[model samples]
Target chain A: MSSPEVLVHLHQKAVLLLQDDANKIEKLIEVQMENLATRKCPLYEEVLDTQMYGFSREVDFAVRAGLIEESAGKAIISKLERNLAQLYEALDQKSQLL
Target chain B: MSSPEVLVHLHQKAVLLLQDDANKIEKLIEVQMENLATRKCPLYEEVLDTQMYGFSREVDFAVRAGLIEESAGKAIISKLERNLAQLYEALDQKSQLL
Candidate 1:
């Protein structure tokens, strides 16, 4: 069994990781925008899918690892999913504009 | 020029968005792992690149927008980049392991 401190540490680390992943994804979006501007193929889609799925799993793991409550994690993840969807839509629109 | 409050709000929003993006990336990683387990092609790479670039740009924008200081933004973005690199490595290793 994991100690409470260990669990807390893992939870905090997961949160930090999640935050970092989000930053990376946003950067990818910016790149996509630039690619569109430059008439590039927007080949970063595979990477984005990997990172997004990884992030969601980490959140779920954090909840299972006893670092966060399921409700809170779900709420946060839901908000994140919504934001991601919006970002995806934004990217799609930019692609169409190109 | 933006008001201080407006700047702060934007900065906070950027941070929150960054965090959410990070969460999404992690979920993507998990999916990649599962896909590898199931022999999927990991087509999310494009999306990851777009998001990572977008997130970095947002951080830079936040700094320029007076939402965060350059030093703090740089530090945060740097840490995020490092974490992202680690996560990428981990995913690569996992892919190879499959």
Candidate 2:
């Protein structure tokens, strides 16, 4: 019963929402890294572990919710994972610098 | 007094550290989004706001530390900001869905 325009609007909105979630997750990862580097807190590791799990869940949810095609979700998740690996390497270098 | 090879190694190490920090921050953001979506917690907003600020600081520090070229640092920060804005939108949508 929805018009094409309305459907398009809904789709656009959903895409925006998914993109926003990805951004917030990115910020969270940065904050945790700072905490880990500065405090050497044990909780830092826990936070990182939890965040990784959350990233997986988010990717799954995006696909299941039909917010992204499975191929698109896989592509995005794969890129994210690569970025994450690089980030870990960066942190290790920072520790060495300190 | 440093050899070119050693300098290259140092540069690589620094780049690696910054990348690691970025990845960890990304993970933290994901956890916060999930928490916000599920719990309607005020703390979630606080976490996001703090994270954005942290991202800015990190980007600034990365530049000051000579960890990245100024142009590259600016590009990265701009991208991060755009991503954070998208994340806010995603969380809002998630709330609406709930």
Best by lDDT: 1
Model 2 regions more than 4 Å off: A1-98, B35-37, B96-98
Instruction: State which candidate has the highest TM-score.
Output: 2
Backbone clashes per model, in order? 62, 24
For each of the candidates, the C-alpha root-mean-square deviation to the true structure, in angstroms, is 14.5, 20.1
lDDT for each residue of candidate 1 in A46-80, tens digit (9 for 90 to 100): 76666666656555544543445788768766765
DockQ of each: 0.03, 0.02
Question: lDDT by residue for model 1 over B1-98, one digit each (tens)?
Answer: 33444434445665665567566766665665456545445456666665666556545544543445788778766765676576567667777887
Tell me what TM-score chain A of model 1 achieves.
0.62
User: Residue B16, candidate 2: how far off, in angstroms?
Assistant: 1.4
lDDT of 1 at B84: 56
TM-score (0 to 1) for chain A, all models? 0.62, 0.64
Tell me the lDDT of model 1 at A44.
71
